[model samples]
Target: MLDQISRGAVGVLVVEDDAVTRKTLCLAIESAPELKLLTAFDSVKPALAWLETTRPDVLLTDLGLPDGSGIEIIHACTHRYPQTDIMVVTMSSDEANVLACIEAGASGYVLKDAGKMDIARAVLDLRAGGAPMSPTIARMVLAKVRDGKKPQAATFPTAGDTTSLTKREAAILDLIAQGDSYGEVAKLLSVSVGTVQTHIKNIYGKLAVHSRGEAVFEAHRRGLLKLGHPRSE
Candidate 1:
């Protein structure tokens, strides 16, 4: 069965082993007007079973599950429902696990200690083509790239040697890399938020990255962008 999701709400399927944590996640999704809880499961078995027929817009899953790893779910959803965005909400801070999840098609990773609002916001951000990662997770990802521990292929495209981005798109990328919100970037460029989002979408297409984090990471890796300093307008 499916949820009674609202018209414009993002349908979320939650998979957390801990009963309390699962409840908390469901509550968080329910609290957000833009989010709808499609279903909550505590194990890989039933979650995978449900996934066979239902595709959620977002999958917020714990890495460790009773029946299997959440990576399995990520792969399944990625292959079966390519449109679905996956996020890992777990206690694991291990380097291997972090990289594994990203490789397996998870777009966002947050520690379980993150608050309800942050989790909900991360879901929205993920849906909006932004990769919402915990600060520690973000650091680990960049560190992996900096250390030359690059995987043969990323879930999203990495920057090519001759990646081409228009000046405005590059400027928007730089601003976003500097932690500017969409509205902030819009104001800085004297454009509407929709325009900023359009430029960002084009940036994603050129960079072949799905989320903001991946875009910034790939750009920095290829020296296409300077993270903290936006180019002078």
Candidate 2:
């Protein structure tokens, strides 16, 4: 399964100005079963140069680099390798950083303060097309939306295609749209409780909605799923 992933065999890139962090990030990525360490760079100059050539599956970048900001890397990634997922693993949990990264097409924003396992899970989630954001960062981003501010224009791909979901995720949504609980969906999908949570995360992003009900409504609006489909008990 890992080998079948695009550029998955080679693994992700780590870009941070801090030497210790660069090494730690590489080691952490290597620790994951599916993630192979590619190259660890300390600045945008080299990171961009390498990305122009060998596009990795995921990128762990810090917001502040000696040569440029991590946002520069995000722009470069989207412009060059749109398929590659960018995760900002940094110390800044500020709302501005959270909003800037997402607006620039960042796939996820994880705080360095999160657990090490959270970092590994985040990378895996990114590789599997999931948006893994830190709760703190998630709150910051949501706070802005709750305040009713329009998001700045960003260049995210139009997910009009139906391939945005896996078979299991789609199945789970079919149940969710009909009012299934996380535990019930997990049982139906034959996956663990945590797996169900991850599927819901992907569902929310794909549908551009925050909750199960919103996703169901959005999916109907997009004509991807029928509004009143019967769900099994």
The number of the candidate with the highest lDDT is: 1
For all candidates in order, the CA lDDT equals: 0.79, 0.69
Q: Which ten residues in a row have the lowest lDDT in candidate 1?
A: 149-158
Q: Candidate 2, which ten residues in sequence have the lowest lDDT sum?
A: 148-157
> Candidate 2's residue-wise lDDT over 1-233, tens digit each?
44653343647888999898777878777777767887888999998898888887788899988887998988787667755677888888877777777766676777777866456677776655455777776666545543432222122325555535665766777766544566766776678878877877787777655434345544544445533353332
TM, every model: 0.73, 0.62
Tens digits of per-residue lDDT, candidate 1, 1-233, equal: 13435567899999999998899889988888889888899988898889999999999999889888998988788778866889999999888898778766687889877544467888988786566788888887866655542442343344554677777888888887655678778888899989988887787777666556567766665556655567755
- Candidate No. with top TM-score: 1
Give the total clashing residue pairs for model 2.
0
Q: What are the per-model numbers of colliding residue pairs?
A: 0, 0
